[model samples]
Target: MAKEKIVLAYSGGLDTSVILKWLKETYDAEIIAFTADIGQKDELDGLEEKALATGASKIYIDDLRAEFAKDFINPMFQAAALYEGQYLLGTSIARPLIAKRMVEIARAEGATAIAHGATGKGNDQVRFELTAAALAPEISVIAPWRLEEFREQFPGRAEMIAYAEKHNIPVTASAAKPYSTDRNLLHISFESGMLEDPWFDPSATSNKDMFVLSVDPEDAPDQAEYIELEFAAGDCVAINGTQLSPLEVMETLNELGGKHGIGRVDMVENRFVGMKSRGVYETPGGTILFTAHRKMESLTMDRDVMHLRDSLISKYASLVYNGFWFAPERLAIQALVSESQKNVSGTVRLKLYKGNVIGAGVKSPVSLYNPDIATMEADPTKAYDQGDATGFIRLNALRLKVGSGVEQNAKK
Candidate 1:
């Protein structure tokens, strides 16, 4: 009989490297390592070679950059979903896409089981398993962190390093920087180690090297930069009058936003697993997109429609943050969000300066703003009729007046 095959979500990182070897040894299974390219830049370099050397029988690297941006990141942006009003849902949003692809690879490779390197304590384990269960219920998920045998073999990073050395596995991890980081196209997040403390000041002199995607706001250039974003039906189509694909748009904005220090957030967020975690994130491009998208909506969207959508922001945000991206409710809510964006086409000009994304102007062909009705100048020919004010005000105030009269009668 052929050996049972297991597909592993491989990042070519220290933990996953160790897990790859451990899975082969523990299960005596054929390990197929898979890596998803979601705009990690140089991190993808030498990934396949490393996975192979680490005992993967086969390696698969899929570039899901465009699909990730168009399918996952774009919809989340359209909903204006932000976890805890600060986190851009960078790491949170990427997990579902990775899990989806992992399932696809598992099916294609005829694998009976899939595995991930997410720790038992973190939210990624929930994100990965929930997506897998929702997508492919038949396949087994191997979570090494939750297993007693796995934990006993390698208790910590030091032990994992020792095991890697013993097995001739190439690893770049060290104990010096205790923090771990996750990066993709939208943002890069840092947590664990020194970032575990809720009160840890990332801006302190000792932690100056924590940031990766952006420069320090204080170190940013003194001169401000202005750019215009063109949106069509709630999607950004161009930046500064230059047409670009969704991925290119994000990459371009990241360059500009990072140069100006436009996005840097540090907060303690409530995790779905009933834990509070502190994280530092640099979401340069996403910050620009979120700000400019809202500016465009302000010019084109209806007041009540925007308010109703605003009420669902927290719920939608929770769905994404809690690994419910593949859930039915998220799809239903996304339909409503898509409809709300029918008139969200417009252009917004913004000024970027020292961590500030300031809106300069917004315009749209279907704009609801009527300048004639808003002007202060007195004109008899205009739509404004001053004589109608008294009746309008009286009609609106009738209920208040009636309530006041009722109170006065009761007092008497």
Candidate 2:
């Protein structure tokens, strides 16, 4: 008799590696390990050999970088999605894509169940399972972190290490570093461990060494660098006169922004799982793109439309943060966001200096700023009538005047 087949979302990290071996033992099933290459740099190195050695019957490594940048990151950026006005939703945004691909692989492989390494306490579990429920429905999800038996067996990283040694599973992770990290093309995030205390700053040498995307702002170069970004329909098309693919553009900006120590954020954020967590993020390329995109929109977007889209920013951001990427409301909101970007084509010059992305200049072919109307110097043709101001001011101030009069009457 053949055993049930299970597809596992495997990272070469300690948690997933242990889960790979444990799942096989627990289920006595055929396991297929899946890894999504969404620009985790060299972290994908030797992942296949590791998974195979750890008892995975087969391994699937899909290069999803282009799809991630074009389909996921671009749309989120178009909506200017930021959770709680601080976090750029880096880790939050990546989960749906990872799960989506995992589901696809599971379906193709005829696997009856899918498993992931996301813990019970974090948002990724919800993300992975929610996506599976939405997409695959009939597929069972195997989340070992939520199992009391599994938790008792592993307890912590130390026990997991011991198990790995006993099983002869190859792993390089140590319990010395108390914090956890997640990285991809868009950003790198650090949390848990010493970061759990709100007052604990990770500027110490040991903690600083954990940063993969950027350096300390104080250690950045003394000189500032300026670059221009070109956008077409709210998507960045060119950088500094060079036309590159989506991922290439991101990589270029990451290099430039990291060098100047741009895009470092530290905050205590509300998780979808009903908890507050402190996270430190370095989003060098994403920060540059966000800054440049906003400047470009200001140049070309209409005032009323811009305000309407701005009203949706929080809601759109929340949808992304809460793992609603495939939800109907998010799709509706994305349509509007896409509509607003029809004319968001322009060039924005930005100055990167010591962690700051400052807009130097913005220009668009369809710019709303009319020099003739805006100039302090009077135009010979008199396009603006100065006499219109008296009526405009009185009409606008009428409600204020009426309220003040009513208050005075009440006092009397």
Candidate 3:
């Protein structure tokens, strides 16, 4: 009989490197390591060699940056999905794509089981498992963090480090630096370690060096910079007059936004796992795109349609954050969001200063903003008659007038 094959989502990080070796030893199965390159810059360096040396029979390092931006990030931005009105769902959005690819690789390699390094107490476990459940119901998911034997063997990072040392598995984790970070094309998120304390100030001098994507707001350039964004069907198509692909757009905006110290957010968010987690995120490019897209919609999108979409913003955001990216309800909401963006094509000029994205101007070919009627000065078109206000107000006030008359009669 052939040995069982297990495909593991490998990041070449401490947790995953250890998990790769542990899975090989514990299950006595052939381990196939998979790494998704969704724009983690230097983190992908020498990953293949490390995985092979760490006992992976095979490794897949695929570049999914463009797909990540176009398929996942673009649609979410169209819905203006913001979890709890703050989190951009950076880490939350990346997991489904990672898991989706993992399932694809498992099918190609004929693997019977898939594995991930997400902790039991975190939302990642739910994301990975749920994606697997939805995409490939036949394949089994192995979560080591939830197993008693695995937890007992390595209860803390110290034991995992020692095990790595004993097995000669190279890892970057150390006792001194304890926080965890997840990075992708959309954003980079920092959590755990000292960030677990809700009151811990991430902007303090001691934590200044921890930020990877943007500079501190106070240290930004003294001058503000202006940039224009072009949108097509609610997605950003160009920046500062240069046409860019989805991937290029993200890369360029990250550089620009980072220089201006934009897209730094610190908030305590409720995780899908029923726990409150404090996270600091740097989403420079995403912030710029979101602001520009919103401004564009304001110029082109109808008020009622925008309001109806806004009504579902919370639901849509919750669906994405809760790992239902592939679920039916999310798909239904996405259909409506896509329909709403048909007229949301325009250009928006913005001023980037320090950490603020201030709108300078917005215009669209199909803009509904009729200056003739909206202008305060005398309207030469006479599009809106001033005499119409009397009947309009009287009709609107009739209910209030009737209620007041009833009250007066009762008093009398």
Candidate 4:
């Protein structure tokens, strides 16, 4: 009989590299490594050679950057999905797409099982398994971090490093700096190791070199820069008068935002697994896009419609953060969000200055703003009748007046 085949989500990192060899040894199966290229830049270099040398029978280096931006990042941004009102769900959003592709590769390769290197205590495990469950329930998911034998054999990074050395696996992790990172088109996140401490200051003098996307605000250029973003159906279509594809948009904004020291966030977030984890993230392009999109909405979207969608932001954000990107509820919310964006087409001018994305101006062909009614100096056109305020205020105040009268009567 042919040996059982397993597809592993390989990153060429310490954990995945070691896991690749371990899976081949422990299961005695043919290991097929799959690496998704979602804009990790130079990290993809020499990955194929390393995986092959590390004992992968076959390797798939798929480029999914455009798909990642258009399918995953764009829809998530349309809902303005910010987890806990802070996290941009950078790492959270990428997992489902990665897992979705992993399942596809498994099906094409006739693999019986898929494995990931996500730790047992982290959110990626949930994201990966839940996605697999949603997309391909029949395929077995081998999570080594959750297995007693695997965890016991390598309880710490040192053991994994030693094992990698012994097996001739190429890995970048070392004992001196073992912090974990997840990078993709939207952003790059750093956590674990030294970042585990909730109070650890990532901006301290000792950690000056930690940031990868944006410079420290204090180290940014003294002069501020301005740019304009044009949107159509809620997706950014152009930046500074130049049309760009979704992938180009991200690449350009990352460079611009990084130069201005924008989009650096350090927060302790509650993971889906019910644990609070400290993370530092650099989401330069996402920050710019989010700010510009909101400004565009203010100009075009209806007030009630915007407010209703705003109320669903938390729920939608939770759905994405909790690894339910393919769930029914998230799709329903996406429908509503997509409907809201039909009128969210516009242009927003912004000032980028030292970690701040400040709106300068916004306009849309379908803008609802009417200067005739909104102007305070005079309304010669009489668009908003001054006399209408009396009844409007009295009607709104009736409940307040009734409650006050009841309290007064009780006091008497």
Candidate 5:
């Protein structure tokens, strides 16, 4: 009799490694491990051997770093995507791309099912499942965390540790830290365990050890570094005088920003599963990009257009966080986003210093900022319409003025 094969989205993490061995034992499936190298630096180290040691028949490590930066990160950067108005959606944006690739591999390998380490309660499950549904709905999903046997057999990380010990499966993780973290070049996020406390200040002495990509602000370089970003339709194409690919741009910014301790954010954000989760994120490239893009928008994008997009920004972030990447709604919004970016071409200078990214300057060939129209010392008669603003203000204030008079009259 032949064994059924399942493609697992493996990360060589404790959860996935344990799940890999457990699947081979329980389902008798030839487990094929798949890891996506989405800018996690050295995260893929020794993963192949580790998977094979833990009972995976084979391993696939797909280098999706370029694709992630170009397709996912760049588009989201154009949108200036921030989930819950603070988070840059670093981890949120990476999952869909990886899952798409996983499904593609599943089809190529003739796997009966796709498995993942994502727990039933997290956004990752939604991310993986949605991508699979959108790309390959026929393939079955085997989530060990949701499985009755797996959950019952190992109720927590302790049980999984014991199981790994019993099987002599080599694992480096222990139960010392109850938290979980996810990282990529753009950002590193720390959550779970101690972070579950809403009142906990993540920057406190007890918690200062949480960050990964940065040094302490006090220890950051005293001097500020300024870099100019060139954007073509809201996509960063160059830094200073050097042209860059999407991945090149991020890595450069990450290196520059990390050196200055630039991108560190900690906040309790609304999760897609109707919960407020506290996550500390360090998105150095994203910090510089957002600062530069917003500055450039002042010189290029229309005020009305910027406001319209701003109004829908939260909705866009929510959709991305909730795994609606393939929905028509996201497509409709993204089309408008693309249209808005048509003239978002410019150069923005940013000053990075000790976790602060400030806009130094902005220049654009298509700048809406005309000195002739806006200069304070301009001749009082030409290139402007001050008299027209009287009527514009009157009409705009009609409702407010009338409401105020009505209240006064009633009081009188």
Candidate 6:
């Protein structure tokens, strides 16, 4: 029988490093470390060498940044998805992309099982596993953080550090401030460690160090910067006058918004795993993308269609937040959302200053903004009718009038 090859999603972090070593020892298996680059920037630094040194037989560092932003991020932006009306789904959206690549690696490497470092209590476990199950159900999933043997052997970060030191695996994680962060072009998310406490004032110097994407709002440029974003069928296609790919748009906007302190959100969000977690996220690009997209929608989208879409927006947002990216229901919702955005092609001008994203102006070739119909000072001419509204209003209010008439008759 062949030794079971397990493709572990390794991050070169203490938890993943420990998982890699533990998998080799306990399962007596050949472990292939898999790392997905979804715009995590320097997080993928030296990951291959680190994985190999940490006892993995091989490593696959997958760069899915372009695909992530184009396929995943842009679609979510179209819905203006805000999980529970707060979280921007920066971390949540990245999880499925990473997991999708992990399953692909498992197939290519002929690995029987895949693994991750997500704890049992978090939403990421559900996100990663649901994706794997939806994509490749034949493969086995090994979640060591939830396993009894792994938990007893190496309980926490201290044990993982000691194990790394003993095994000669180099790591930057120490006992001091082990705040876990996930970064991408759109945002940087900080959680765990000192941030675990709900009441922990983020203003404290201790927690202040957790930020990576934005500068202080007060220190932001005194002048607000106005820029125009062009969208075609819900995806941002250009910035100012330059056309760019979806990925490039996100990267460009992130840099512009971050410098101006445009997207910083701190809130206690409910996890899909039936728990609440406190998280601080700086979603610079996403902030700009959503603001601009809505402005464009207002100019081009039909009023009735907009109202219908808005009614289902919360359900769509919840699905993405709860890790249903691959689910059929999400696909159905996305289809309708996409149809509504057919005329959402346009340019939206926005002003960015501090943490606020203010809308300036919006225009579209398919714009529904009829100046002649809406202008207050102009006559609508022979094409319009005012006397028709009297009957229209009376007919619509028939239910209320009939109820009142019946009450008066009964009293008499």
Alpha-carbon TM-score of each model against the true structure:
0.94, 0.96, 0.96, 0.97, 0.95, 0.95
Local accuracy of candidate 2 as per-residue lDDT tens digits, 1-412:
8888999999888899999999999999999999988888888899999999999999999998888888999999999988899888888888899999988988998999999998888888988888888888999999999999999999988999999889888889787777888899899999888888989878776667777888888888988899999999999999999998888888899999999888899999888899988999999999999989999998899899989999999999988888888888999999999999999998999998998999899998889888888888896658888889999999999999999999999999
Q: Compared to the true structure, candidate 4 yields what TM-score? A: 0.97
Q: Which candidate would rank higher by TM-score, 1 or 3?
A: 3
Better of 1 and 4 by TM-score: 4
Per-residue lDDT for 340 in model 4? 91
Q: Kindly report which residue stretches of model 2 are placed more than 4 angstroms away from their true locations once superposed.
A: 204-207
Q: Give the best candidate by TM-score.
A: 4
Off by over 4 Å in 4: 410-412
Clashes (N, CA, C under 3 Å) per candidate: 0, 0, 0, 0, 0, 0
The positional error of residue 142 in candidate 4, measured at the CA in angstroms, is: 0.8
**Most accurate candidate by lDDT:** 3
Q: If both were scored by lDDT, which would come out higher, candidate 1 or candidate 5?
A: 1
Error of 1 at 342 (Å): 1.3
**lDDT (tens digit, per residue) of candidate 5 on 288-316:** 98888888888999999999988878888
- Report lDDT (Cα) of residue 4, candidate 6: 89
Instruction: Report the error of model 3 at residue 370, Å.
Output: 0.8
TM-score for candidate 1, please give it.
0.94
Each candidate's lDDT (Cα)?
0.92, 0.90, 0.93, 0.92, 0.86, 0.86
Clashing pairs in 3: none
**Full-model lDDT, candidate 2:** 0.90
Task: State residue 253's C-alpha deviation in candidate 5, in Å.
Answer: 0.7
